[model samples]
Target: MMLENSKYLFDRAQKFIPGGVNSPARAFKSVGGTPVFFDKAKGSILTDVDGKDYIDYVGSWGPMILGHAYEPVIKAVQETAAHSTSFGAPTEIEVEMAELVKRMVPGVDKIRMVNSGTEACMSAIRVARGYTGRDKIIKFEGNYHGHGDSFLIKAGSGALTLGSPSSPGVTKGTAKDTLVADYNDLHSVKELLNTHKDEVAAIIVEPVAGNMGCIPPAPGFLNGLRDLCDAHDTVLIFDEVMTGFRVAKGGAQERYGVTTDLVTYGKIIGAGLPVGAFGGKKAVMDVVSPVGPVYQAGTLSGNPLAMAAGFALLSELQDKPVHYDQLEEKTTYLFNGLKKVFDKWDVPVHINRVGSMISVFFTDEEVVNYQTANTTDKELFRDFFHEMLQRGIYLPPSPFESWFLANSLTQDMIDKTVAAADKSIEAALESSKVDSK
Candidate 1:
């Protein structure tokens, strides 16, 4: 597709905005091309500035589950905006949102809203530390828990894509308390708990890791972590910013049947609005703000506009619980179709999927953790990505990121996407053969 206007916009944006994008993932640095500037999106389609329409698979990085400009969400936002935007005070909508969330999600006794997932995660850790009176926390490798200073160490997604999991700005002192463990590996977590003993306050993890591709927790992985936390007197936190309400209504905790002490949410909770929330058992959550010693506050925590949009989106999901099943069916269809295409093209690829979240890694090995996920042939993926883009299918810019499927995608779109994959795989295979020679 010709992106002249997008290129122009990017050039102009770079004069003011660093890397011509606010978010690093939007820069298309890993994909080796100019990022397409989208003018508008509706349903499962994104129309770029140059008037090229592509089937969107990124879903705004997991928020647009119902799809872009979904009627209910848009209507709610419009209706709420006419009243006011931010009041800096509590509203009935906030209370309603909390009640609705608690009704749908399991194990959440109280929830605090925030502007973004990063803030939710950062505050959750602070609350955990305050509640437990311990300073250290263990985080799994390859699980991107937002870009908080503590989470930057061995982070995934943007950090891994930029080849800097440990960012420069984060101080050494901040990194010390953050312990890193391998995902899908129970032994590593047990080892960390044994070494840290009473010093560890919490164990944070992405129950269904979306960063470093879509890796699901191993057979007993989540339960094992829960057990370890129980034995160590540590708070177990599920950073479900990506998996929450996407994989399942209540998220990984609900799907896996393993309860967590704290859970952080983003994306779907705000219905694509800038919002996030962290909630847990009343005892742990009580430590935040007026009730307890932990200091955490957001001026725009539960902005009326955001609450309305989120409530609308959540209500739809609540009313139509079948949407989850429909999403799974579509995702399975796409995954199976892609697998068939790769097989036909004789391209060695590993596809990881969990519900509506999926990833295509150009490798034969199973991608269980960061180490294995890194073994993918990025060059082949870049070729595949461009080929798919050219065929009007928009994939995640980086192999480290998950492709979020929206309910808006029809069977026709999935079939077209499969056809695109067939051609893309052929081209990628040809390119790999040429490179080998």
Candidate 2:
């Protein structure tokens, strides 16, 4: 692929934008290279600024489940935008969106829209605090609930990619109230709850750990949390920002059959637009805003364009319901194919997947949490990433992030990606050997 255009764009981008990208992970600091500048995308392929075509696995970080340039979503956005974008007030579409979400997701009695996942999560925690009248929140390590101040400690994805889990600006007072627990370990949670007693307001977690690369809940883990929360009168908040609707039509809560007091969702609900939401039982959500004292407000909370696009995408899913099966089949096919390729190369890689979310860790150890996830051979992963990029396979830029598979990915693309992986693994091994010397 030609890189002249991409290189030029990145150079210009760095002069104005910190780290040459708006998102920290986009800087490719974890992989050590220039990020590809995409010009357009359709179905499963991304066309970069250099005019090179590549299979997309990132799926715009989990909202492009239907694929890029999806006609229905585009048309909906265009039509809705014609009647003014922001009202700073409620619209019927907002009600329609909430009703559709209620229809698809059985437990949510009411939902409030926000501009991004960060807002959804931050708002949910405040609601929890207000409703429970407690001062602390327990968050699982490596389970990123956006960059909210309380969530920055031991955060995953962008934070981990930059080699810093805790950021500098977060205050010591804020950090004190945010308790960190180990993912998949019920004992650590028990210890925290025991230590905090009635002081903990909520236990927020990513039902399927995506930030540290697609680690699913261990058997009975989520249920255990529910029990613990119930016993302690603590609210359980599901940060389904990445897994919502992608894993299932109703999100992980429906898939796992584990109910939570509140749930936070991200880009998937907006059909890849800038939107998010946090809602669950009316009892808890009533604590937020006009109903109660806990304050939360946004200028573009229910922007018509986002509401229209989300309704279109979600209605399609609710009607067909076959997209989930297709997504599962394709994701499993790619996972198995890539597994065979890695096995053939004698590489010690551990791959984890739940529904369409998956990741490849360079270590042989099962990546159940942050500690095991860190054991991955990042140097080898960097080499493998570049090699795969060279072969027109656009993976997530960092090892710590999950690779979101889209339903638009066809069998042919999967086969091509598997074929590319064989050569990429070989080249990566060679590069690793040279690096050692």
Model 2 over residues 1-437: C-alpha lDDT tens digits? 46899899999998999988998867789888788999999998999988899999999899999899899999999988889888898899999999999998858999999999999999999999999999999998888998889999999989988899999999999999999999999999999999999999999999999998889999999999999999999999999999899899999999999989999998988998899999999999888778889999989898898899999999999999999999999999999999999999899999999999999999989899999999999889888899999999999988999999888999999999999999999999998788889
TM-score of each: 0.99, 0.99
Shift in Å, residue 120, candidate 2: 0.5
Q: Which stretches of candidate 2 lie over 4 Å from their true place?
A: none
Scored by lDDT, model 1 comes in at: 0.93
Give the clashing residue pairs of candidate 2, or none.
none
Reference-based TM-score, model 2: 0.99
Alpha-carbon shift of residue 250 in model 2 (angstroms)? 0.9
Positional deviation of residue 63's Cα in model 1 after best superposition, in angstroms = 1.1
Give Cα distance to truth, residue 248, candidate 1, Å.
Answer: 0.8
The Cα RMSD of model 1 versus the native structure comes to 0.8
